[model samples]
Target: MKILVFSMATIMKDVSMGGSQRHLRELLFHLADQGHQITVLTNRRQDNSEEYELCPGVQVLPILRFKETFPIPYDTHPFHLAHSYSLIRQYADTHDVFYIHDAQMDYGYLHANIPTVASIKNFVYPEAMISAFHTNRNYLIVSCDYMYSCIQYTVGRVQPQITDQLRIVKNGVDLSVYKPVEATRKSQLGLTDDDFVLLFPHRPEASKGIVQAFETVRELKEKLKGPLKGQLKGKARVRLLLPRHFDVHVSKETEQFYTQLTQEAKEFQVEESLVFYPWVPGHDMPQLYAIADVTLCIGQFIESFGYVQIESIACGTPVVVSNVGAQRSIVPSGYSVIKVDYGDTESTVEAIAELASTPMDITGVRQFLDQNYNYKENLLGYEELITSAGKGSSSVFSNTSLKSGSPMDVSYKLAPWCYVSGPKKGIYHDYFYTYLNQHELYSFLSTCTEESFSQMELVEAGVSSEAIEKAIEDGILVLYTP
Candidate 1:
């Protein structure tokens, strides 16, 4: 199969820098290995010239170059839609299946009349985009069930017709590159053999929970101050490795945020415990993972599926993740990974303190990864689905259903607040009502307004707006459909 993968965020030369780029590169490589010809169409804004690279059977075509004049979120670049459309049109002659990364590029793919597999990387905007693209006959692949459910719930309330296209394909990690490294690499980074390093190798953004990790470390240190011995002492010296400047721009706001976080860590008197490193080179990431006892992925928002946790597990290190989205699915049971509820500082502290002493079974961790998170196996599953879809099969993937027992449910715990419906939008009101009660969850719920609801198809099976409104009037966290 000749696949044209369209991504607005990927710059071919900087594959290792961003999650979307890394995912594109890895998937391209795997597809190429399976004897499929792959071409990538992406924005060429990083440099003035349009560049092309031929890697084995895979080719990268950079087109529609544009420069940014002001600060904007990376995904919402104005030039994205125009650039993506022009490039896809330019290469439309040879492409087979169009695999798009983000929702913003749906317009381009729809214009091209391409049979696309649009993968939802985040819960936000996916519902709206899927609803808008409902008639396009595109397969909506979600990275995790958590994201799939979030999309279903959000879209079901507004545009229920697009639910049939929803499918779950959990992101996989390349173990060949992210596995355990030599002992010498640890010494090179000034990491002692005895140090219990807890890595937070994401951007220094507040939503990524870098600040929360620092605070958790501070609290843990304070709790261990008075005569806590042995295992607790190990936890007290917990090292936090935070990567500096992962964002495209180091804006004034970002600078202030970083400064404030650093100052707060200093105030907590655990400044020395945090180690700041420039973004780890793609090749050296395995070494970084090898040195860490636990990798922390504590995002407060609904992360589609965090690749860092899988990368950590691939390197034989456990992950301590905040209970959100697909992260829970990625770290399976009986593994070295631990899960803490979102925003619960005390639980995070307790998890870190406990893991500091527990001996990690490296072999067991590797075995679990091989069984669940292995890139080869996971990519093969993707290949089968893509191939089936290309062959005009009604069921492209066997487990396209976003039900809880699907393989995509690996990191996702059955949260009572979320539910998945078919490709057509249908509300699961029971879960929505429960989710709205929690103050934090309620904030996310409130974001769903009548305008948003207009995007989904409301089913008669769902709780009526009148009933929900009455519940809300009675001070209950009820979902208002309108």
Candidate 2:
């Protein structure tokens, strides 16, 4: 099967945009090896001329040519959606199945008339998009039970018809890379075997709890640094591997946090407890995880399935995670995944301090990972999703359509297609059409009086404001007031 993926994930050892991209890349390579032809169209921008590091069988291309981001969020960004549509238009018809990463691109694939397998990695998918796909029942991929619940509760409110398409394919880790190993590379990393490393192998951002990590370690430095006389006792130093820049396209808010973190690290004297290394390569992650006594993955964002916890546990390291339903849902029973309140630095420090004495259960954690989070087994699940979606199976990954809960206002309606007869022409009506998409048009229609629509709507929908005025001149659409 030829799969055309419209996601910003790379199968190569290049810059990553976090877990979603990493999951896609891992699955794509494995699927490529399974004899499926894979092609990825992502936001490489310009100047991303580095070679793709995957098998020669897979093809990767950049959807956007220019570099830079729209300052606003995705909900109102027409420019970003236009770029997505341009990419979808380029290859939507040619592929056997469309695998989309986010709900913002639903309009692109819906019109393409192809079977789609979309991942609802977050709970933020709009009701308009969810309702749009009610007729076709596209496969909505979810990574964990947490996100599955989120989709059920949120989208189910606006569209009760939305639940049937949802499916769970739990996140996986390459256990081979994450398993415990001798620190042959310890000295090379400028560390002794005796150092009590507390790794936070993620981007240096506020939501990632970098601020908390610095504060927690700084507070616990004096307590953990004493010379010990035990089986694994050395000068207890907390070495943190924090990436300088995040792998994804971050806004100024996160950029400000990043800038502030670097400056305050010295002020907080975080270096005393945690040795901060910036931008460590992915290959070195296993060693870091193995060497560390405790790892902090206290991200504030609601993670559908956090890779840090999975990888840490797989590497036989105990982790301190955000106290939330999302991260908690993935942890196996009897496994100690320490939870800390979102911004409670004192609680986080206590968790770390408590974990400093407990030994990592390498055998047990690996068993948990193998049983649940192994890449090969979960890749098969993904392959099944693609093949089943291609076969048009209503029986997706789950045995039944999902259930629902909380009310999320994903309020937008798409305009229905209309037929105007004047010697029937193409798929569309005989003459001029509205500039806005169904969601945008209906939203405008909601705000406008019954007698008239606004020129701003037309401009927002990619038509110039003058287009409506010109259309009125050409007798395309009559212009009047309510």
C-alpha displacement of 345 in model 1, angstroms?
Answer: 2.2
Clashes of each: 26, 1
* TM-scores, one per candidate: 0.75, 0.71
lDDT winner: 1
Query: Which pairs of residues have clashing backbones in candidate 2?
Result: 153-405
Q: Which stretches of candidate 2 lie over 4 Å from their true place?
A: 9-15, 47-53, 65-84, 102-104, 108-111, 124-137, 225-236, 246-257, 271-274, 278-281, 394-482
lDDT string for model 1 (301-394, tens) is 5566777877777777777887655665667766777887666688787776666567778787777767766677667766776666666664
lDDT of 2 by residue, 237-303 (tens): 5566555544334446657766677688888887544454545445567777766778888766556
Tell me the deviation in Å of residue 182 in model 1: 3.4
